[model samples]
Target: MKKIIFSSYLKLKSAPLAFMFALLFVAASCDTQDDVQPDSRALVSDNITAALKNNNWSAPGNSSAKERKPTFNTLLVALAKTGLTSTVAKEELTLFAPSDEAFAALGLYPNNIGNVPNLEQILLYHAVQGELYASDLSAGFVPTLNGAAVEVTLNGGVQVNGADVILADKRALNGVIHVIDEVLMPPTLNLVELALSFNPEFTILVAAVQKANLVNTLANDGPFTVFAPTNDAFVALLNELGFPNLDAVPDETLRDILLYHVVPGRIYSSDLSTGDVTAANEDTFYVNTSNLTITDANGREANLVPSLLNVQATNGVVHVIDRVILPELGN
Candidate 1:
């Protein structure tokens, strides 16, 4: 089994040059706002120090660190537009505040945030119930207020759902703020809905779930990691068994086969290693992300399709497998 061990984070002393300009700008003009570079990575680098201020947000009328920190002007406006400034002020919550440059990337501005289809859900996806400091941030899924968990990876850097956390551990009166490079979107669809959305590709898998009467199980109750087999894999399995179609397979056997592909959790590719992984059916398989292969209990191996990995859903994550490896079943 691959043991998930979260190590202590080593804070980088030298930050990028952009946020450094904030300290100099503090001396130059504390009252003036500098021209923000509207680039993707620049989103995190620009005005990060300013974002680290201990603002309770109770006082939004003045230019104070304890009031409205200038770096997060875009975020502040978004909160105000959503009427969530008071919520951040009183409720002890964590805000994964995206930079102004991040908003600019999506063509969003202080005046046009209403253009977003679901602004509140998008905004709530960035905030969690309690303070999640840099130290407290571990490698896994952390549930957001929008009812979806954002995946966190601390390997190369701290990334929340692929957005880099450029600045972390900034104090706030009500909670804390972690400046991210990009905005986070909570998944609107569950696993079944997501699979259905990708119509042709997941058609057979969807059909199999329906056949097994596990549609509701896959749809509603999960945080599951599904290593799904393609239709070609199912066809090959049928040919190997001398069966004409899915209808020829026994219901209990099909259920066991479907359950063999699923694991109970939102496991990402980073969370995998070269070791045994227990499936929902109590059968075990060996996964090696190094070479992208999974060896089933029956000794048959299938390669994990890298191009189709980590397709996120509201209830879980899905990774495509080339072959449908089976458990040891008596003929």
Candidate 2:
């Protein structure tokens, strides 16, 4: 699996005022290993009743199963509420089960599960349609039966929405279970929800999207690859422009600025290069050191110091850039 590294972008000090056309250059850098791989182990195929009957699930330190403790009562209750107990008990599936302590930490209760807006959706998010072990998880958006997808970010630690997988590859009668540290929520409200859920630090990016009237566009479709700028990126731009804040800039300008950072297709970090790549607006810009540094037509340079790169969404990918990419005046 390709490990998605989340690092924040750095603040730049200059604004590009003139367009400078240059030939594209492909830098010969070290080939970044793409960690997108699926787990090789198949799902547990034994009969559910027999597996549960023979498995001594109560012993906390039992090496027969995984080291992690299973929330036997909580899991049963949640499955019953979602009407998935029978299916889960019969079929082969991989459940990324979060412990009861995780739910307690989130202040959620079993009785209140039905009251949550997307509780069923959230519960389904833990289950993979088919059987998969820890090796099956790759660095991409994996769809759930709930009509929503969750990102599998495998890096130094396996993470699902910044929550690490504490224990992996525990075999069950009907499926395999990977214990996660926190509850994973499904992405909603399109890209806005995705940004907020993936990293709360992108609040500024979300606000800018609302201000630009492009929230709906981003939410729509076409698998856009957004090079999102962090709050510090916007603040640094304002400082360079000698403005008190982003509000000082006209909405039209802000819209153009934000749009320039987005491309029409889903471009993963492994696919990026140092060259003049066309953006969604049909304007071309230069990327030096792969996406480490970006230069606009007007000789303005905005370094792509991302806090987190390769954030996958069902419809697109998000790379959090430190500074906003401004478009040409006439374009």
Candidate 3:
């Protein structure tokens, strides 16, 4: 429900630098709200029957292989529908396979969702370009075949974009399959667009961005991580700076401060650690994941809101913070 469009970091050991999108800081259910009520299980069963006809359908596993519950019935349908079943069976790629329940959360089943826009792209968002096992997964931004990146988190347990990996390192003919809990929908907007979409929540943040003339910069194909402050945070900043409103703040100063909130990569909450994270302003801020707080160069600390973390956008990632990070002014 917190719609500030922000990003953060938790752990980053080392991995391939693939980028995904920044999130629009809304709850997942809100993002998946559609007109149609969830389709019945009978429809899902029908899709599975149709998908079974695709001989290329080898994921979840061949019957001769390890005998499991075949939980990926819906995923199998998606892959078969896209002719991606053959690809998953033959290609050396990694798939974060979501279960039927994951798709059900979006009111999607194989047959019912055949008309969904960009179905192929949505399926591709769940895959990477190479065969990566759980061991190969380091916490960082990993580019998916969809041309966007997915966030990998190894902090407590392995999580992809925020979906828990209930099962990991399931081998495929050409790649690995990791069963995940949620279906990750690709981000549709960039940082600025995402913020503006939330209206009054980011009204002040969006204003500061426009006044600073950073709309285009933030909207560009950046894989940037923005530790966005809430509207309340901006108000608190105005009180701290003894200013009545954002208009009283100088442009250069606002720009500098805003820039300080942005880091140059797609850092997820899992990638954050206890260290100095340099911002886009060429200044650095300290993050302590232990306390979930960011300390700017001025030694002032801002807490990352626990619930509003790791929202993805088309060009970047976003983490909603409770305070507006400050950068030193007047040298």
Q: State in Å the error of residue 48, model 1.
A: 15
* Residue 276 of model 1, lDDT score: 96
Q: Residue by residue across 1-331, what tens digits does model 2's lDDT show?
A: 1121111111211323231111101111211212222222343444433343344344344454564545644555677787877777777777777777787787766766556676676777787877677777787666666545566788986787677887776676567767777888765545666888856678778888888888888888656888887878888878877778667778887887788888987676656777888887778888886448888877787766555776656567777776777778653
Best by TM-score: 1
lDDT of 3 by residue, 198-273 (tens): 6888899999999999999999857899999989999999999899999999999999999999998788777788
lDDT of each: 0.77, 0.67, 0.77
How much lDDT does candidate 3 score?
A: 0.77
Per residue, candidate 1 scores C-alpha lDDT tens digits across 1-331 of 0111111112323656675555455544522333332222323432322333333233222444542332566677777788777776677788898877788788888788866777887888888898788889888778787766788889777899999987666565567677787988888788889888878877888888999999999999988999989888888899988889898888889999999999998888867888999999999999987899999988898999989987888788889998987987788
Kindly indicate the candidate among 2 and 3 with the higher lDDT: 3
Clash number for every model?
Answer: 0, 19, 24
What is model 2's C-alpha RMSD?
Answer: 21.0
Task: Please report, as a residue range, the 10-residue window in candidate 2 with the lowest summed lDDT.
Answer: 19-28
Stronger candidate by lDDT (1 vs 2) = 1
